[model samples]
Every structure is written in structure tokens, then in C-alpha cells.
Target: MAHFEKAKSIHDWLDQRLAIDKVNKVMQTEYWIPKNINFLWAMGMVLVITFMMLLVSGIFLLMYYQPNIATAFDSVNYTIMREVEFGWLWRHVHAVAASVVFLIIYIHMFTGIYYGSYKKGREMIWISGMLLFVAFSAEAFSGYMLPWGQMSYWAGMVITNLFSLGSLEMNGIVEWIRGDYVPAQAFLTRFFMLHVLLVPLAIMALIGIHFAALRIPHVNNQDGDEFDYDEESAKYLAGDTKGSKVIRFANDFLSKDLFVVAVYLIFFFYLVFWNYGFAMDPVNFDPADGLKTPAHIYPEWYFLWSYEILRPFSKDIGLMAFGFAQVIFVLLPFLDRSPNVAPANRRGPFAIWFWLMIVDLIALTAMGKLPPEGIFSTIGLYAAVTFIALWVALPFITMMEKKK
Candidate 1:
């Protein structure tokens, strides 16, 4: 009874200041999720768990990591991996999480697309999610440079060079971005700041915005069935939960999220412990050497589809296409004119377009990893053209879609 009173007192004290009950209702206990969602709805929770793993593992690595171009490679390869206790485990966890997070993000993004979650009033949710993706991309790129490896240096050089706008010769912008003609000390320092502080902060802010966006529309169900959230939530609160079409976010939905997260963690740790080599590039094992470029310099796989889009054309055309690809996704809510919010499989030609786009992106990713020549180049060009054409055809096909 004494311990119970103490807990009550603490809660009352905090609630008086923070309105804990109201905030809890607003964010969790009274928050409603559709009962019709599948396990795929849990991807958001999985992403959060993966990000937490990245943060914890990154903090461990940061304690030993030196950002200097001279010592960064040795700091990672020799000092951390060899000298520090269990440093290899931390590195492996970080690397695997970094790579695997993108895979999860892609799944989450496509799930949103497949279910038409970006349509109508849910635009901000998709926009915020895309912003988070951009933030994560910047974070990954900046973190990659910290290793100061052969692939890291060269990839940085290649990417930064894109700022040189063809005949416009915006070399000054490229130099300014790098803080030099090449990726040197200044470049490393800047990216280190971005990776550790700026980009992560942006990502956190975007995540909060994403959640806030979800609150109004709630989550779209797999079947795209619309219901009165307020009425269903009242039913749930009134002890009619079994009859209601919605569940509370606190314990009910959270339990489902936890189950899915547990399974994902099992798969994630398997990669961390056993198959982490896929995340760690072989070329990155070598220290940064500006004189000798690797046979192939590519961004990580997540960026490959876009890289392929840029590669298949001449300088100006490729740049335009790359810019289009980057911004087109954020504009999906506008481009898709369909009134139906059902999954793509039920949406006629949209089903074909969705699967074809998926196939094209897969082809682009595969082709991106290879040298841009002969058969690969031909395939990549076709894939890139198909990607653009699909987006161009989105409004027309979706407009013709019969409203459900």
C-alpha cells in the first residue's frame, strides 16, 4: 500500500504539470489503429527499432572513431576492430543495421504505395516519410565517408562531381561543397558533423512530423475500408472492443507491433552475427587512395536505382532524369488521380504499372552494380526510360480508374 501510494503521488505530481492523461490519450491509449491492417502495418515499428539499434551501435563506434583523413581508416580497421573489446561486434551491428534499414524503408515505402496510402488527405504522411528517407540517405552517405576507404573516397568524389553542371561548369559549387577540389580533410570534417549531428536531428524531426501526420487520417487499412474513427474508438473505450473495428494504440496495437519487431530482430541479428560481410564492402577494406580508383565505384545498393537512371543518358539528360526521379516520389499524391484507396491489385492497370515499376527498379539496381557497357548498358537505358514513362503514365491510367 505504501509503494502504491508513492507511485500514485509521483504520477499525480507529473500529471498536474504535464497533463499526462491527456497526452497519453492523444498519443497512445486512446489513439486508434484499424483492426484490418496486416503484419505489413508493423513496418513502421520495425524501422524505429532498427534506427534505435543504429543509434546505440553508432554511439559505441563514435567513441573510437577518428574523423581525420589520415587516421580514420586505421581508427576503424586497426584500433577499433582489433584493440577495443567487442568493437568488431559493434561495427558489424552498425554496418548491418545501416544496410538493412534501407531495405526496410523500401518495403515500408512500397507498402504505402501499394495500399494507396498517399492518396487524398494523407499527402503529408508520405511527404514526411520521403523527407525521412532523404535524411537517412544523407546520414548514410556522410557516415560512409567516415571510414575513409577506397570506395568511400571515390564515391564521394564521384557524387560531389555531379554538382559540376555539364557545360554550365559549376565547378565552384562542387569545390565549395567538398571544401576543396577533392574530398580532403574539410570534406571529411563536414560530413562527420552531418552524419553525427545534423542529419540525425533532421531525421528525428521528420519522424515526429510523420507520426503527427498519421494521427489525423489514422492508418489506412489493407482493404481501404473507411470508418468513423471517433465512433469506433468510443466503442473500444466503452468495453465494446471486440465489436469495434479499431484498437487502441497503447497495449493492443503495440502488442502486435512488438511481435513483428521480435521476428525482425531475429532476422536482423542473424545478419549482424553471421552474414554482415554483405554490408561491408571489400573495396572499403583498403585505405583511401586517390591515385587508384576501384574497378567499379558505386553508391550503396539503396542508391543504385537512381544512380542507374543518371548513368544511362548523356550528362545533361541524365542530370534532368535524376532530378525528376528524386522529386517525383514526393509528388505521388498529385500524380495519382485515382479516387479508390484500395490496394494496387484491385486497381486494374495500376496493378500492372506497380509491378512493372518494381521490376524496372530491380533491373536498374542490378544493372547499376555492373559496368555501364554493352548488354548491361542497354538494359539499364531501357529500364531508366521505362521508369520515367511509368510516372508519366500514372495520372492518365489512374484518372481512368473507376471510382469504388
Candidate 2:
């Protein structure tokens, strides 16, 4: 009798304090989720989850890893070859997650472009995403140098050269960041902290803002409709709540989220287990020496297109050209001015231009990987020309559309 009364009293007290009615109303409210989002939409969620995996795995690795230039290389090898149980598994997971994160973000960015998700109200969201991309690239590059292999050493050298453009003039700044005449102890230590701490924190905060902004606007559908969005009239559909809100997170939507996450994990595991991690060249394991440069130093796969752009240009032009290419990617939202979000309605001129840009990127990536010989240089020139044409042509197509 005493126990029953206590339980009843607790239940009644909780019921009075909780807003069960408000919670129920939200769960029952129908959100305007885009039905045709497909696997690409899932990529953003996959990226967020994968970052979590990397963070967890990285923390474990750091427990045993050293960051000093003298020990950094050996520390990584020790973890993989001898130190902890399943240390190899942890290292491989971190590497694979890095690649997967980039792959997913790239697809997600294109999906945004295809849908024109960056237009009007969502421009800030797009900008934040672009920043995230830049941050992720820095994180990857820094982390790559930590393993202290031949590839890692020369890679550090090549990338550091980018900072040397006006080094003769900006000697103070360059030396401070490099901490020595070359990539040395301070560089490794700082990069280690950034790869594990600073970059990830910034990424998380930006991602939070990204999602908050997204939720405010709600998702744009295939038909370019949010809750009140109207396509034919090019107006808000009207008669919906003004501010953003979420219903119960425990309904049908939760199930779909779980399903998508599960599918991605399965794919991740297949790569992790079957493929193993990509092996650094045995030569890269050696310490950095400015006297000995590697025969060919390539940036990671994701940077290949930009690296390719620099390949064919003369030394004087390469860096400038690559820098210009990056500007275009950063300013893509402004460059594309389709009034409607969907590309399906975009005319032949716009459609054709988009495809041309895609092809140019592919060509550039291929050229970046190839030796700087006759065929590769020829291909790079063609790709560079085509890339410029496509970029300039798109705005022209839009202009013509306006006149029509």
C-alpha cells in the first residue's frame, strides 16, 4: 500500500509538470520533409556521424601518440605495428573516416547546387558549409604530416612552399608559423593540436549553426516548396507557423534517420574491414630533409583538381591560377542565379554549362595524378580552357534567359 501510493504520487506530480499536450501536438504536426531527397540528402547526416567516429577514434590514438617531430613518426607506427590492442583498427578507422567525410561533403555540396539551396534565405548556410570544407581540408593536410613518412615529409614541404610566395618580404610571418627554417618540431606539434582539437571544435560549432539555420527554413522540396512555398506563382504557400520548431523527435522520422545511418555504417565497415586503410609509402616514414625532395608529391585525392590546375601553368602562373579556382568554389552561390531551385526546369544552356564544368573537373583531377609530360600538359590546358569557358558561359546563359 505504501509503495503504490509513492509511485502514484510520483506519476501524478510528473504529469502536472510536463507539457505532454505540447509535445503531442508537435509529434502529430506534419513537417514538409522533401520526399524525393534520395541518398544524397543522407550524406550530410552520414558526415556528421562519421565525424563523431573520427573524434572518438582519434582521442584513443592520441592517448598513445607523440606529437614532437622526433617522436611523431615513430609514435604512429608504434600504435599501428606494436602498441595497443586493435590500435591498427583505430588508425585505419580514422583514415577511412577522413576520406569518407570529404566524399560525402562534396556530394552534399552538389546536391545543394542542384537544388539551389543556397539562394535567398539559405546563403549563410551555404557559406558556413564552404568554410567547413576549407577547415576540413586543413585538418586533413595537417593530420597527414603527423605520420612522418616519406609522403608525409615531402607533402609538408610542398604545401609549406605555398606559404613562401613572398617569404623574402614576409619572413617574420612565415618563420613564426613554420617555427624553423623548414617543417620541424613546432610545425608538427601545432598541427597535432589543430587536427585533434581546434579544427574539430570549429567544425562542430559551424555544423550546429548550419543545422539551426536549416531547421529555421525547413528543407526545400524537389518542387521548391517548403511549408508554404508556391512554385507556379513564385510565392510562399502561406498559412503556416512563422518561426521554426520541431515536433517529437521520436516518430516516423526517427525511424528513417536510423535506417539511413545504418546503411552508411554498413558501407563504412565494408571499406574499413575489406579494403583496410591506405598505406603510406615506406619512404615517407623517413624524417624530412630539404636536401632530398620526393620525385612526385601529390596532395590528397580531394585536392587533385586544384593541384591539376597548377600542373600545366608556368611556375609564375600556377599558384595564381589555383588560387583563382578556389575563389570560384567559394563564391558559387552568387555565380548561379537560377530563380527556381530545381535544375530540371533550367534551360539547355544552363544544363550544358553545368555538365561542361563537371567534365573539366574530372579532366583536371586526372591531369593532377599523371606525370607532367606531353599528354598530361595538353589535357590540363584543354581542361583549364574549358573550365573558364563554362564559368563565364553560365552567367551569359542566364542573361540571355532574362532577355528572352
Candidate 3:
């Protein structure tokens, strides 16, 4: 055994053993962030807060949630909402956070694209972020099934059936996924396992990877200026803080993040207390009945854009388009051939391309919610085609951008 010195205090003792001070220095105190960033940079913190809310509320809700199909509906609708004390509040927070998290994620993603944050050296940040997106999507889908409501059941059914691969007839994959021919006991149990355990763990791991990726590349700023971080950070550390172009991540940058998070919490609670109906589908109020199908079955709004891509074409073609939409975004760092790393407005045709893509996706989302008929069908088809065409055009349009 090694000789030991008497500890100064609990923190000192722990720091000596665990290197808490070093961790703080690395992850917080010494971590330098560019001062040129705006509130959009705070979305990562907001996402963490929202995910914490989801996890806490989910744990409380899970305490009373019954996985069995026969009791799952009543456990949520009656027992948790009406019987448990303040369970309704937890449910509302969860429902609103689940929806709002995606809103924040979209804003974060677009902000990244707009600022060219995904360009050059920060590919892992983008890729890890996309992986987090995929993990969260899976978590949401699995959680949606836990309610055992009409829309939940049918949405699960419809989404799972896609695994059948159209004419390829690989429905064994579907049944294997569902753990039965239908969304019954085994299906519910499997999804409950995923929602409550597996996917959340995956999300947490991906969040770690995402943050780690950010540490090396640092964060891209609004101006996309490639300043010397080491030099600026030295200035900050050496007491020229006001003159430095960077700030410590601990008190300086975190203060800004907290301000944005506070504002977001205000908006979030407003939804939870009053406007949460948007997050909870009205159709989900009904208990799942395999015999009854809603006249119009649609996914939650966040998924609408991609769903519309799959809606307009023939089955095989639709699947292809949908797959393209899903995978194309992950390939964005490679797709944009421009050497420049600046806001879209500064980049010639790329600016138009960015705005058009945004508008097209918005159009696709709107059409996805409406019944596919008459003018809606025609518009969705055009929008779907435009979406794929835009991605195909990205490399060529960006290649023409003059070096800046």
C-alpha cells in the first residue's frame, strides 16, 4: 500500500482520486468556445435539458405503465392520468418535450447547414449528431407504441409493414420485428424494452460521442471564421479575456447557454400546460381496436416530410425515395463540393439551393398531413421529385461556387 496524505476536504479527496478538477478543466473550465456564436449554438444544451425531462418523466410514467396490451391503454389513460398524483403533469411534460425536442433538433440541424458547420474538419460532429437523430427517432417510435392507443397501434403496424420490401415479400422480417404476426403482447413487451431501456442507452452513448466530436473540432460560429483557437484561448487564460476572441466554456459560455435554455423552458412549459394537444394525437384517445381503422392514418408531424416522399410514388419507387431522404442527409459533408465554409447567403447558387430545399421540405410536410387526393396528391408528387432532384443537384451547384 502507498502512503497517503490527509485530505483537505471532500472535494479535494475526490479530486485527488477521481481527477474531478482535471475533468472540469478539460470539459468545462478550460474548454474554449468562440465568442462569435449566437443563441442557435445553445440548442445542444436545450436538447440535453429536454432529454433529461423525457428520461425523468418516462421513469415516473414507467412505474405505472403496464406492458400487457389488455391493460396498457387503461394504465396510461385512466390510471396514470386520473389515479396517480400529478401524473398528468408528468405525462404532459413528456408529451410536449417529445415533440419539442424534434423542433429544437431541426433548428439545430438547419443552423449547422446554414453556417456550413458540417464542412471540412467537423464531419464526425455531423455524423454523430445524425446518429443521435436516428437513435431518438427509434426511441420515439418505440415509446409511441407503449400507449396502445388507436394511432399508436396502427402507426406501428404501418411502419413495420414497410420491412416487407414490397414485391420481395420479406415479411418474416416484419413478423420478427413485431415478435408476432401483429402488434400484440410480444410486440408490446419488445417495444417497452426498447423504449424504457435499450434505445435510451443508445441515445446516451451517442450523445457522449457527439459531445466528444465537438470537443476536437470546437464549435462552428455564425461567421464561419477559422480563427486560431489555441492562441485566442491562451489570451483568455492569461487575463486578456475581454480582448480574446474566445471564452471559457464553464462560466462564460455556459451562462449564455443557460439564458437560452431559460427562454426555451418558458416556451416549453407554455406548451405543456396549455398547447400540448398538438403533441398528443386526438385519434390516440381511442383504445386500439384491430377491427377498426381510422379513415386517415398519419404519422406525427415531424415525420411528415419523409412520409410524403414515400406516399407519392409506386411502392418500390416510394421506398427508394424514402431511403434516399433518410441517407442523403448523412452524406451532406461530401455532397457539397464547395471549398468555402460560410453562411449560405454568401455562397452564390448554394443560397438558392438551401432555401429551395427548405421550402420543398415544408411543402412536403404540409401535403403529407392532408389526404393524398386531387391537388394535394399532385403537389406531394412534385415536392417528392423536387426533394430528390435537389440532393442530386447539390454537388454540381456547390462545385460551381467560387472559392471564398
Candidate 4:
């Protein structure tokens, strides 16, 4: 009873000050969530935590990083890595954390795709996420140029020139983006501003909206089955009953989310400490030199799948294709006409096509690393075709599929 009184006093204090209980009760989350969701549900929270890590580490990195082209590379290699206290650790964390963040984000996306998490009533959640991906890609690309290395310079040129292919105004836009005729100190400064300031703000805003939208839909689960929340809230508002089978967010997910976060952090920091530069482009270590280019250039591995898609066409046409590719993914909720939420509910080519697309993507990512010539380019072209074909054909294929 003494302990109960103490807890009651604390609760009363918080309630009076913040209306804590009122918000929780109004949100319809008594900390409960759908019990059917597995470990995959934790991925979003992991992404949130990783973003926070990047922000903190990035702030420190900015303190030492000189955005000027002349000193950029040396500042990182010497000042950050060798001179500043714990600067090496922070630098590695920033560089390595970017890769880890992207890795998990890809998994989080695929995990959603596999479970049909975007189906009905949750379209906005998926759209917000997809838009977040767009913002994220732009953020990563801009940040990549900050190092001002050979890979950064060449990759920036290759990517930014894609914007140069349109009308006269489009070319002007390219110049505006670069801040010069070519990628130079001015370009780096502009990129630094976007990478460190504008983009992060955009991402934070999107994240807030994403969570707001998510709470409305309540959340999706692995079963793809309807939640039967009437069991718990039968006496409550009928409006809240529309999306049921829910549990309180704090109850079902908290422990599991924490456990996964712990594991993820361990693996993340392990990479930061032990294998900091794994899978990074070796050519990027060299200072940028426009006079001589690396024999072959490629993006970070997460982007390789899309890069392969870009390889088969001319600059203008490929830019069109890539543009479509970026937006179409988030539009999946509308694009797919199938009524069945779970892939298993349909016993037909939908599942086959789904796995095929996954395989095709994996193949394309692998092929991206190989030289885009001879037999390899041919294979990449075929793989890209297959990948696009599956997505394009999903609605019709699902229509023909037999429902269980």
C-alpha cells in the first residue's frame, strides 16, 4: 500500500502536468499492439534509433569536417581520424553507421513487402515511408560527396548530370545544384548545407508525419489478418472499434523492441569498431581527380539494384525510368488491385512472382558490382526487365490467382 501510494502520487503529478493518461487513452493505445506481429515489427523503431545515432555522430563529424574541397579529404583522414580525440571512432561510426542504417532500412522495406503491410487503410503509412526513402537516398547521396574523394567526385558528376538532360531550365537547375560548372568547392559547400541541414530537417518532419499517420492506421501485422479488438474495448467508442485486434503499443512491443534494439546496437557498433570500412569503395580513399577517372565506378551496395536499372538505357530515358522507379514503389498500395492481404491466401503466381522479383533484385545488386559490359551487362538487362515485369504484372496475376 505504501508503494502504491508513491506510484499514485507520481502518476498524479505527471497527469496534472502533461495530461499523460488522457493522451494515451485518446490514442487508443493502452500500450497494446497486434500480437501477430513478429520481430519484423521492431525494424521501424530500430531505424528511428539509428537515425538518432547518425544525427549525434554527424554533429560531431561536422565540428571537425572542413567542407572546402582543398582540405576536405585531409581533414577527415588526418584531423578527424588521427588528430582529434575520439575523432577516429566518431568518423568510423558516421561512415559505417550510414551503411548499417541503409542495410536495415532495406530489410525493413522488404519485410513490409513480404507481409503486405501496405494493404488497405494503411496506404498513408507506406507512402510516408516511401517518401522517406526518397529523402533518405537524396540525403545519402549529398553526404557521400562531402568526402570529396575520387568516388565521390565521379559519382556526383554521374548522378548530378542526370539532372542536366532536360530543357534549358533543367540545365540551369543542374548548375544551381552544383553551384559551379563542375563539382568543386562551391558544390561541396552547397551539398554540405543540404546534407547537414535542409535534408535532416525534412526527414525529421516526415518522421513526425509518418508516426501521426501510423497511429491512425494503428499498425500492420504479419498475419495480414483482421484484428478483433472488440474483445477488449467492446464498451468503448464504436469509432475506435473500426480498427481492432489491437493491443497497447507499450505492452506487446516494448520488451521485444528493446531486445531487438539491443541486438542491433551491438552489431552496429561492432561494425564501427572492427570492420569500419568493409564494402566501401577503395577508390574513394584517393583524392578527387577529374583528369583521370577510376576504371569502373559504382554506388554504395544498397543503390546497386537501381544502378543496374539505369544501365540499359541512354541518360534521358534512364532518368525517366529511375524517376518512375523511385515513386512507383510507394504507390504499391494503389497499384496492386488484389483483395487478398496475405500472399498465402492466394494460391497462385502472385507468390511465385513475388519471390521472383526478390530474386531478380538480389541478382541485379550482385550484377551491379561486375563490369557493365559483355555477358554481365546482358544479364543485368535481363534481370532489370524481369524485375520490372513482375511488379507491372502483379495486379493481373493476382486477379487470376485462386483465393484460399
Candidate 5:
């Protein structure tokens, strides 16, 4: 009887301390939740869960990877190909999840843009998302170096070399990152540290700030209005908000979040198991030898546009023209001025401009994959022409339409 009484007392104490009703009341009354947010809104929660997946799986990878050039590639094989238990499975999961995370993030950003989620009071949230994007890219780049394969070596060399212009020494940055003289023992070790530790810590801190800002400002809805509490329809709103966030200690915006996470996990597992995982080539397993260049040097999919832009230009033009083009591409959210946030009703000329930008990106990606010779040069020429047609012509077309 004494033991049972003690357990009952402890359970009651916990229950009283975490009264869910009190928290829900505060959110429902104080926060400005939009009544119509659907499954699309749940993506932010999915991103958070994916990041957690990466963090956990990444820790295990760091334990088995050797960061030195002499043994780095061998170490990877030893873990995935030979030694460590379930290391391969964990690695592929991390890789596939990284790709999926970016895909979801892009969709989330565009969804916010289309819905005008960045307007009015939500500016801080939008800005935070952009900063998070930069951080994520850095994290991915740092981690990409860990496998120490051929793709990793050349990709690092090519990307790091870009900063070599304008007195930013590529070697110095590379050395600092590597914690050594070259992309050797020190480089892998430092990248591994950033990939597994520092970057992840920064990402988590930013995520907390991002979610808190969203919560405080209240989630934006498709209709861009606060919920009506008096109407019979309003009762449905309350139930939806309550249902969406019914999880203990979770805010009203997080109920649907758990479901989104489950779907992501299922998709992630399918990819990891179905695809054995991306291979680091035998040629790249050997350390980068300056004397022999690989027949074709291609960047990973994400950076292909920039690489494609760089391909056609001469050394001088490549440095200035391609650099300017990329800067403009990154500044897209500011460039297009369609007051109509949704792509559908951007009037006449504005719609054309939007379509052109999409086409330009597709053309650039295609050009990037081709060699800088023969037929590809012609394709690059057309890509360059279309880029001019859109970036220059489309804006002018929009102006003319406005004038009319």
C-alpha cells in the first residue's frame, strides 16, 4: 500500500505540473492561427524532423570515418564496404535524407512565397529561412568532403577555387578548414568536425529561433486572415487547430507535423533500401594527383548551374560574366516584382517573365552536364542567348505591359 501510494503521488504530481489545457488556452486565445492551413503547412515540421535524422545518423558516421587523405577513402570502404555493422545503411539514409530535406525546404520556401507568407508581420520568419538556407548549404558542402572519394576531392578543389578570386586565397581557406597544409589529414578531420558538430549545433539553434518566431507571430493561412471565433464555421476552425496540435506540450501548429514526419521517414527508408547508395568511384579513391585530370569533372547536381555558366566563357569572361550571372540568380526574390504573389494571375507580360526564369534554370542545368566542346558549345550558346532573352527582355516586357 505504501509503494502504490508513492507511485500515485508521483504520477499526480507530474500530471498537475503539465496541465495541457492551460497551454492550449493560451495559444488559442493569444496566437493568430489561420483556420485554413492544410498539409502544405506541415512541411516546416517535416524539415525539423529530417534535420534530427541527419544529426543522429551523422554522429555514427563520424565514429567510423578516417579523415586523413592516406586512409580517408580506405576508412569509408572499411566501414560501409567491410567493417562497421549497418554503417552503409546509416550512410545512405543520411545522403538520401539530405537530398529530400533540400527538396522539402525549396517547396516550403516557394509555398510561403506563393501565399505571401513573407509579407506584413512575417518578414523576420522569411529572413530567418533564407539564413537557414545558407547555413544548410555550408553544412552540406562540409559534409560532402567526408567520404574523401574522387568526386569529393575534385568537387572540393573546384568549389574552393572560386574564392581564389578577389584576394580570397583558396589554399588558405582550404588549409584553415582542413587544419593542415593540404586536403590531407587535417582537412578531413576539420571538415568532419564541422559536418558532425559545429554546423549542426548552429542549425539547431537557428531552427529553435525560426520556430519560435513563427509561433509568436502566428502561422499564416492561405486566406491571410485570423480565424473567426463566433460563426458555426468558426467552431470547425477551433477543432482543426486543436486537432492539429493535440500532442502533449506541442503548440497548435505541430499536430499535423508528426504525420508529415512519418511520411518522410517512410519515403527515406524506401530510398535507402531500394538504392544501395551512391558509390565513390575507384578512380577517385586515389588522392587527387595534379598531373592527371579526370576525363570529365562534374559537380554534384546542386551546383550544376554555376558550373554550366562557367563552361562557355573564356577565362576573363568566365570570371566576371558568369560570376555576375550567378549573383543575379541568387537575388531572384528581389528581382521579380509581380504584385500578384501567386504564379497564376501575374497578368500578361509578368507571366511570361516568370516562365522565362524557370526555363533559364532548366537550360542552365542541361548545359552544365555537357562538355565544353563540339555540340555542347552550341547548346551553351543557346542557353546564353535564352538567359539574355529572359533576364533582359522579360523585365522590359513587364515594364511595357505595365505602361499599356
Candidate 6:
């Protein structure tokens, strides 16, 4: 205790002038984090590292990238890959990292939903995370066009025109968004600006809000008891600094988080260097031609679940369905209203149905990639119906679970 006081006295002396202690209280070691959160809790940390890698690599790529209609593909494939220093490595990392980031986010969001992390006080945090996902989806789409490859061009065409699926009036909205009738130079330029500047700024702001929201509510744990750490944490707090039911953010969780992040990077870099073509399509190697379309135009895997729902419907219905698909997560806080939180102790039928929905999502993703000609459309219809039914029935189903 005497040694600790000497250390605190020095910190206080520094605080009298530097204000370093105050800053550290908010931005560094002072925040309370629940120590009981499991491996699933590290998903957010993985996302943070992934985004950092994407940003650093993307900045380097931007130094050589030309986003115009005439030169974008060659700029990325030939100039950046073959000419620039370590450019190939960065490009591969950026590409692989983007997909990995989304995978982590899906796990994070699913973990939240499974454990009821959004139930009472954490609603804003969940909503902010969902908004971040939306921004990420938009950001990824915009970046996809920067390659200016055949798949990029067609993907741009399919998605930009998707907005016009409603009616004649919707065409005007699509035109406004595209700034042209088709995915031409104007579309590319605007998307470039969005990818480089606007979307990233939005992402940064959303992340700030996400963390700020977390400050008040303790991290959700496996037990489903939000204040489960109260009794245990109280012993660690010295004197009257003993309020929050939490552990030091820097050590308790940081050590475990760093280990998981290190493990994740090993696999990610493995895919980047060795298995370099994970989610990418080979058609993306060919420069974009306005006149030619690929025999099969498939979206990236993350977008596949929604893409499948879109295949069997009329334009208007499909548009609505697609919109709902992106925003489905925002509705989850309201959907599963069961008082129980732990996945193992979660209400009857909810867990079974939730896992089934995950399976349906995987099935739909597979169907999305397959050509929609023969068997895929039928499978898509079934998967889509089952998915929609699960979400609609989730709240009522969980309300009946026996509570802890």
C-alpha cells in the first residue's frame, strides 16, 4: 500500500500540470470491463485490428491507384501489384482483410443476439454496431468498383440499378444516386469519393459512438447476468473508487484479446499470402468492358444471403426484401424479448431456431453463388421463406422460454 501511494502521488503530481491522468482515465486504462466475457467478446478487438490493417494498406494503395474509367484496373493489377514496393502484399492484405473483417463482425453480431447483449441498457451500442455494419457494406461496395475489373463493372451495374426496382419514379432516384443512367465514369468518381472519404468518416464517427455507448453499460458476460461481476470486482476497488463491477481494461481483457488477435492474424495472413483467392472471383482479373457481362455475376459472400432473397421476387418486392435484409439486425433488439440471456439457458425453441437460421443463411449463401437457372431458384425460395419466418417469430418464441 505504501509503494502504491508513492506511485499515485507521482501520478497526482503529474496530473496537477499535464492532465495526462485525466486523458488516460477516458482513453486508456481507467475504463471498466467485465472480466468474465469469453472468447466471443474478442470479436470486436479482431474487427479493430482488421480495420487498422485495411486503412493502412488502403492508404498505401491509394498512393498509386487511379480511380478513373480508363486506367483503374491496370493501376491496381499492374502498377500497384507489379511496380510498387510491397504493393502486392498490401493489396492482398486489404482484399483478404476486408472479408475477414466482415466475418468477425457477423460473429460479433450473432454473439450479441444469442446472449441478449442488446436487451436493456446496451440497445444504443447494438444499434451503433449495426449502423457500422451498414456503413461497412456500403464502403466495401464502393471499393469493389475501384478495381474496375469485369466483375467490378457488372457488380456496380447490378447494385446501382437495383435501386430502380420499385417503379418509374425510382429510376429518378437511381439516376440521382448514379449521377448517370448507367455505371459510368460519374458513378465511379462518386463511389471513389465515398470509399476514400465519406464512408470512412462515417465509420469513424459510428465507432466513436459505439465505444461511448459501451462506457455506461458493463460488458455482457456468458452468464446473462449483466451485474454478475459486482461482488467479485468490489474487492479490487481501493477505498471509494469502488463503484463499477469491472476489471482493468488494459490487462484483464487486453492480454486475452491480444492473443486472439494474434491467432486471427496468422490465419488471415495465411489466406493473403498462400490462399490468396479466398472470396475473390477470377473474372475480376479482366478489365471492365461495358459491352461484356460474365456468364454468372455473383456478389461477394457477405452479401450472398440477401442476394439469394432477391432472386425469386418481382422488382418491387425484391427491393423491399433487400432493404429489409440489410436492416434486419437493427430490429433484433426488439425481436428477441426473452428475459433470459445465456445461450445455454436461453428460452425454448429460440436456440434451435437461431441455429437453423444460421444454417439457412449458409444454404442461401451457397444458392447465391450457384447459377440461378435450375435448382437454385427453388432452394432460394424455401430458404428465403424460412429466414423471414424465423425473424418474425423470434420475439414470441423466446418470450415463452423458462427464465433463469
Query: Tell me, what's the RMSD of every candidate?
Result: 2.9, 5.8, 1.1, 4.9, 5.7, 4.3
User: After best superposition, candidate 6 residue 275: deviation in angstroms?
Assistant: 0.9
Q: Where does candidate 6 have its weakest 10-residue lDDT segment?
A: 1-10
- Which stretches of model 5 miss by more than 4 angstroms? 1-33, 166-182, 223-256, 276-291, 316-350, 381-404
lDDT of 2 by residue, 74-177 (tens): 77887555878998788888888888788788788877777667776788888888988888898888888888777777787677767655324455566677
What's the distance in Å from true for residue 330, model 6? 0.4
The model with the greater TM-score, 3 or 6, is 3
Q: Over 4 Å off in model 3, which ranges?
A: 1-3
Model 2: residues >4 Å from true position, as ranges?
Answer: 1-32, 166-171, 226-250, 277-290, 344-346, 402-404
lDDT of 6 by residue, 48-135 (tens): 9999999999999999999788999889999999999899999999999888888899899889877878877788999999999999
Error of 1 at 328 (Å): 0.7
Worst 10 residues of 2 by lDDT: 229-238
TM of each candidate vs. truth: 0.97, 0.84, 0.98, 0.90, 0.76, 0.92
Q: For residues 1-404, write the lDDT of model 1, one tens digit per residue.
A: 22323345878877766789899997888888999999999999999999999999999999999999999999999999999999999999999999999999999999999999997789999999999999999999999999999999999999998889776889999999999989999999999999999999999999999999998888999999999988998898899989999998989899999999999989998998989887999999999999998998988999999999999999999999999998999999999999899999999999999999999999999999999989999999999999999999999999999999
Between prediction 3 and prediction 5, the one with superior TM-score is 3
TM-score, predicted candidate 5 vs. hidden true structure: 0.76
Highest-scoring model, TM-score: 3
For each candidate in the order shown, give its overall lDDT on alpha carbons: 0.93, 0.71, 0.93, 0.80, 0.65, 0.84
Q: Write the per-residue lDDT of candidate 5 for residues 1-404, one digit (tens) a residue.
A: 32323335664655466644556555544444554667788888788778888878877877887777777777776756578888887777778777778778877876775565664556678777877876787898887787777667767766666655634445666556545554566666777788877888888888877877786556666655544333422543466545342222244455566777788778778877885243223455655554566777876555566577676776556666567665554444444443333332344666555556567667777778667788877777677667755665644554455421
lDDT of 3 by residue, 1-404 (tens): 76567889999888878889999999889998999988999999999999999999999999999999999999999999999999999999999999999999999999999999997899999999999999989988898998999999999999999999877889999999998999899999999999998999999999999999998888998788998988998998899999999998989999999999999999999999989999999999999999999999999989999999999999999998998999899999999999788999999899999899999999999999999999999999999999999999999999999998
